[model samples]
Target: MAFFQLWNSDHGHVLEACKDSLKKLQLDYLDLYLVHFPVATKHTGVGTTSSAVDDEGVLEIDTTISLEATWHDMEDLVSKGLARSIGISNYDIFLTRDCLAYSKIKPAVNQIETHPYFQRESLVKFCKKHGVSVTAHTPLGGSAANTEWFGSVSCLDDDVLKGLAAKYKKTPAQIALRWGIQRDTVVIPKSSKVERLKENFEVSDFELTKEDMELIKGMDRKYRTNQPANFWGVDLYA
Candidate 1:
């Protein structure tokens, strides 16, 4: 499991807390350590029910702690052997570019909400150009926990998705995951169910054809299922 840092008054303290937690967990090293959001907010620990919100009830952006500073700390973690690699989560192209400019140790990966419904091709291309691996969270279009976002808009229920699924003899979720992997992005679909876990990993066996891929690509709704409203004041994409 990955550990996300909490938003605190002091970013340094947050990094230290993460290191301490790693020691308590007895993890020799973390495969990847990520900045949970672009801005710091209240943290209720891993798997907590609290949402990322601000004083105005808008989703907050975390650009206050400069990307350069965060990247530097991440580099330190890698150099000190606490983490094998460092990366960012929920960063857009502009923020990513800033990190690239300032980072001595380029990010190993960028984890984001990517799926058939929101195939972030441009951001994916930018990451690749800079030699950063892209990891997709919500590869199956998110989880049941964020049902308002993922469940309300059912990509699986689309006729086109269903048709392709039938033609390929695969589930819509599998097809979605396959699309991501085929594009050379690592997909991490969240599911506690044993069967779903097994199903998500089974995407490697089949390949979606050009026609099938085109059809899926055409399904892009540009849906951003996870943007925090508090980011309105921050120029996250700038």
Candidate 2:
């Protein structure tokens, strides 16, 4: 599972809490641990609050803590046998480059919002160049938590996606997910619905054609459903 919002002040506490949770849950250890954001924020239970915003509205930025410090703490977790591997989530290319420059242990994965509309080719390429795996969150477009952006994007409702879905005998969401897999990225489409969960995992059996992939790629409108830019000026990645 991914671990986010860890830092020096509470890094040890967070690590211990995770260990206890894993023990209680009867899991041997997490396959991967991720710093959810580059910055720190007020924690409310298991979630965090942010003041980040963009042209659309307010959003949370990364924490004020340095990324290197966070990485150090993460590496400590590995050394102490708390996590098998550590990585980052929602990090931009610039911050990722900084991490690469100073990190003792390079991130094994970089999880970000990736879909046909916002494929993030440059960032993906940067991570690949540094031997970091790219994992796509919201691979089937944005989640229901932020329907405004997702609702505005016509790709989800486009006749092209619809026609392609018909051709592949799959849902539009499934087709979108297949695109990510074909691009060689791990896709995580969150849904508590059991049927949808099964459907999301079932894409492994079929394949999208080269023409199909190109058609989907050409549909990019640079639409990002999640943008917590309010903390842009902060030294979260330092």
lDDT (0 to 1) per candidate: 0.73, 0.73
Candidate 2 lDDT by residue in tens digits, 19-105: 654665677667677877666543333322334345655333335655677688778878887778888888899889998888898
User: Which portions of model 2 miss their true places by more than 4 Å?
Assistant: 1-17, 20-28, 42-64, 148-154, 229-238
lDDT of 1 by residue, 1-238 (tens): 6555434323445457556658767787787777665655444453333555557655443455665676787788888887877788788898889888888888888888888888899999999998999999878666455556433365666788788789888888888888888888998888889998898888777899988889888989987665444343443433
Each prediction's Cα RMSD? Answer: 3.6, 4.7
Worst 10 residues of 1 by lDDT: 229-238
TM-score of every prediction relative to native: 0.84, 0.80
- Regions of candidate 1 where Cα sits further than 4 Å from its true position: 1-10, 42-64, 149-151, 230-238
lDDT of 1 at 53: 59
Which candidate number has the best TM-score? Answer: 1
